[model samples]
Target: MSHVTSPTGLRYHLTHTPPHLTAHSHATLTLTVHNPTPHSIPLPGLTLALPDTPTGTATPHTPGPLTLQPPQGWTTHADSPTHHTLTPPATRDSQPHELPPAGHLTFTLTNYPTSEPGTSTLHLTETPHPGQKGTDNAEPLPLTLTTWPSGTIVNPPTLNKNRYNNGDTATIEWEYSPADGIDYTLTYYPQPAGSGNEKNTVTYAQIQDHSGTAMSNGLRHAVYNTTVPLTTDPVPFILTATYQNDTRTYTTIASVGEPDAQFGKLQVTGHTTLLSTTPQTLTANGSFTSPTEGFLVCWTAPGTAPNKLTVNTNGESRTLSYSICSGSLTLPLAAQSAVSYTADGVSGDQYSVTWIPLGHAINQ
Candidate 1:
């Protein structure tokens, strides 16, 4: 049930038969528009949207034959199966019928139950006239249509990789249609007791919808070392999907493969002379090693990144460039670990660049 009264004393009320809308059967709804203003106003056209069958098309949501049974002395017409428009009657003098003060009109609308469960709204506008064409009211009234699903098609969430390796990109996909609204959530479970990581569920809210193709914010790809703990073998990934005002929810989980990529040895170059052709000298600071040689990618100073064995400093702020090597390259030496990665791939220039210190970047 929904009703809205305008400041001008115009009121609209609606109620449907069968109590609630269901997919298995047809439904009849009663709609009433009342003019309570002392002065008679021109009759208005009632505009309503009907449900579109899951016809597989975005527009013309429905190929319907919606029926409108107006009360005695009233008339109505449908612009389209899903779009309905009701206008005022013609007076004997050919003048448009004016709704007298306190006068009201009622209508009974019927529609076969739609297999695809979804919501729609109803609204009203001024009836069109010869010189005064119909115009939408400044404020359109809304009446929500609630529905019950009999057999709704649901697509479960799927990840690109059942098992993920360090630096591996993961794509999450599912068939999604708007159900009042859209929602997607991804959660990374805490490490198993001991992995040198804080045991807490990490959640990301930045879900993107690429026509329901890829809906993730760099889950396994972005700085995998950190997003996915290095020590935790096979991280558990859970994704939940739902919609606004929808009671049904869908969720799934899969174990992501462990990460083997860790820093060999970090050699932090405290200083470097790049312009000279004779020979560039670099000064190295002692760095740490994590059990030596276990990695998905080996990065080198090929002028591809600043750390061609180069180090970044807030004090200097040089955008160092480095290169991506097929084999592993140790950090040689390290200071403190602070690293971050972008989702770009090794084939590209963004071959696992580090934003944090060499330590954290290597281990993570």
Candidate 2:
């Protein structure tokens, strides 16, 4: 229930316009055959071929000689308007022979130089002269041919490492937008150094603050405030984007605090007498190691200077100072009376201190 024919014939404007053909190699089709009953439409003898599919087919060879035109007094003749097999349509008394009421018809399909551009379906017929009436005759249409191929496209760039700790903050983000001219580079590597490579490469327009929207879920943010140190180190993360011409590299994997706890080591060991006599009892043993294997301890003094250092450590006190210096420690131990220290738990240094002596200051 719809009708509007004005493809302006020429085979419906060359089977639907758009440079139907160009150059020494033709491919044109404009066939608009519509006689909606009012009478006058007869032109038969059609043949367009193709049939041999067992999962292998490539056919195209029909050039030099193919002409069918009608747009004036309407008088055409064609027992062989030339057709040399473009393959596909296989059937119709073996096919060939088409001429109608001369209402409309335009054809100039050629191809010969070994063609592979595909799409086939063209066969029209309408023949009934001689007290004619075989359904009025003229109906069988199909024409399509388009070829354009050659390509390569790869676009992948993203990274956003938001939340961070152990030194306050950090943020690093990224993204990409480059058209064909091809030549890119953006890189990063370092985080508990697990090693994935590409530790450096930058030039996707030189990305630092990367203010050009790159956090499309590939998250990479950097906002470090500073000073979050006491022990434990290992903030070795990575983010990469590469194409320094070609080998392609896009990666993002992070790690902070696990590579032996980043970087730290402070050790100043045991017993700080500094000269003790009456009521003598001063000791100072220390240890603090990092690299993931943590440990801690501390002790300071100078006659009633026990500020807060009493973690005698397990195993009582054999004058102390054995495993108390495990991973890291900062020593400034001055003494004369009571002093003790402990911290040999390990793992980024846990922390411990002890100091006591109230009766050894020249009996003041």
Candidate 3:
């Protein structure tokens, strides 16, 4: 029979189909024991013996124990004293009989035989027959049993993080390969830095779009985050992913204990003051150059500004005013350039013209 070896070790499959067997008759299955490992092994022949005296004592000597080389799980159990009697027939209460100067003999396994899939161990000890000096018996040997390996086996997943900006949006993805019989659950925890007295918590969620790729075997997905704004402090994070119904296994794919990737700056910059000017009236409010998407622009005014005037807002404005009152004001260069002359001759309320550049010039 052929078999596939697992990288985790300790398993051998019997590939061939079983043959039809007659009732009460033994069936011998032909199988090829192949060791997935690259190394080879050598095993010893089994031997069994009995003691002549009721009390047995064998001279101290190391009889070679059974050896099972790679790709082999076959052991021999001869009908010798050690193999046959673990507990002597209680009725007789009689210990086995043996001869002095007893030497070792080899026995090949028959009856319950075959190189089947299983685990095995052997015990090689010495004992001297009671009242019989120099006469010793072999110690009892061990038994072996074979079975299939089962339960979920999981390999660690790799996480990939891309560059993102402050206030911008980015996603974290993970990939994992699971065994044929296993299922998994992945949880993601994103904690921003400086979540203390200086900063507020940012609420985020793990989004699972119907048309998205999953970290595990497409079994499940989810999102989590706070409602406050995210910060730049070293925020700790954790992810707990598990195989379905696996209460006996655990592994860390990523953790707060290890080095983590930081979030992007999410920079935002635009006019913050509302323009109650004379022309090109507009209203706009939203994130500025967010990482996930771009900015948004909206305008609403009773009548368009007199000239091609620029519009700006502080995100929330519901009223507009245009009354000439002596006061200090701030304006963008684009707005100032669109205007002609202001009453330059005025005392008590003097004019202070400020210039702001709206276009970038390449270096020479």
The candidate that wins on TM-score is 1
Kindly provide the TM-score of model 2 when superposed on the true structure, using C-alpha atoms: 0.18
Question: What lDDT tens digits, residue by residue, belong to model 3 across residues 1-364?
Answer: 2233222221222321122211112223222222333442111222333222111122321222322222123333335433421121122344432212222122222222222112323232223335432223433332222211232123333333332223322233333332232233443223353445333322212323321244545433333333332233223233333222222223332222322345588555984433222232121211121111112122222232221222232323322222223433443332212232232223212322222233332111
In angstroms, how far off is 4's CA in candidate 3? Answer: 31
Q: Which segments of model 1 are wrong by more than 4 Å?
A: 6-8, 53-63, 128-140, 151-364
Error of 3 at 51 (Å): 33
The TM-score of candidate 3 is: 0.21
Off by over 4 Å in 3: 1-162, 166-169, 177-181, 192-364
Provide the lowest-lDDT 10-residue window in model 3.
285-294
What is the per-residue lDDT of model 2 for residues 148-222, given as tens digits with 9 covering 90 to 100? 111221234322443333333344443443322334454443322444432444454554345544344443332
Best by lDDT: 1
Each model's lDDT comes to 0.49, 0.34, 0.28
Off by over 4 Å in 2: 1-46, 49-81, 84-121, 124-135, 149-364
Give the worst 10-residue stretch by lDDT in candidate 2.
1-10
